[model samples]
Target: MLTEEMMTTTEMILMTYLFEIDEWLKDKKVIQQQQAQLTKEELVTVIKNDLTTFQANQATDYEKKLQTTLTTLEALSEAQFQKMKLEILSWGPNVKHVD
Candidate 1:
């Protein structure tokens, strides 16, 4: 039905349209690849950012816990020193001399 010797205008138009469709499909594939690469890059950036924030938060939480422990230790030391002082004072007036 198709030959170069008897080529029709309708056949020429159909061939042109087929070539255009192939070109369009190629262009679409290229664009999709580019978009996929961009999406991957953006995801990596977001993950890095989240990891940094999580590390910062962990550091801050550790520092706060350290400070709390130090404060509690200091308070206990102070209370122990006061108790010793009170006991010594109480023994002063009630101490009996061994003659």
Candidate 2:
């Protein structure tokens, strides 16, 4: 019952709508890709920051351990020196001067 002209018009309208929808879909895909890229970049930044913080903490712990070791060694050396000096003094009056 439809005329040929009417059918041609209807086909043209449908094609136009299909083209618009395709363009919209392409734009949506591009937006999604951009968002995904931003998310990836943000994640990378966070990981780098976390790694930096962790390295700093490890260095601080190592420095503290080194300081403690050095302090302990210094204390031991001081005690040994005191004992040796006392022993030398106890040999008083009988110690020969080696010229």
Candidate maximizing TM-score: 2
Name the TM-score of candidate 2. Answer: 0.20
Model 2 lDDT per residue over 12-34, tens place: 32222223435444542112232
lDDT of 1 by residue, 1-64 (tens): 3333222222222222223435444542112232223232342344344435556534665344
In the predicted model 2, the residue pairs found to clash are none
All-Cα superposition RMSD per candidate: 42.9, 42.5
Candidate 2 has an lDDT of 0.35
Runs of candidate 1 with Cα error greater than 4 angstroms are 1-59, 78-99
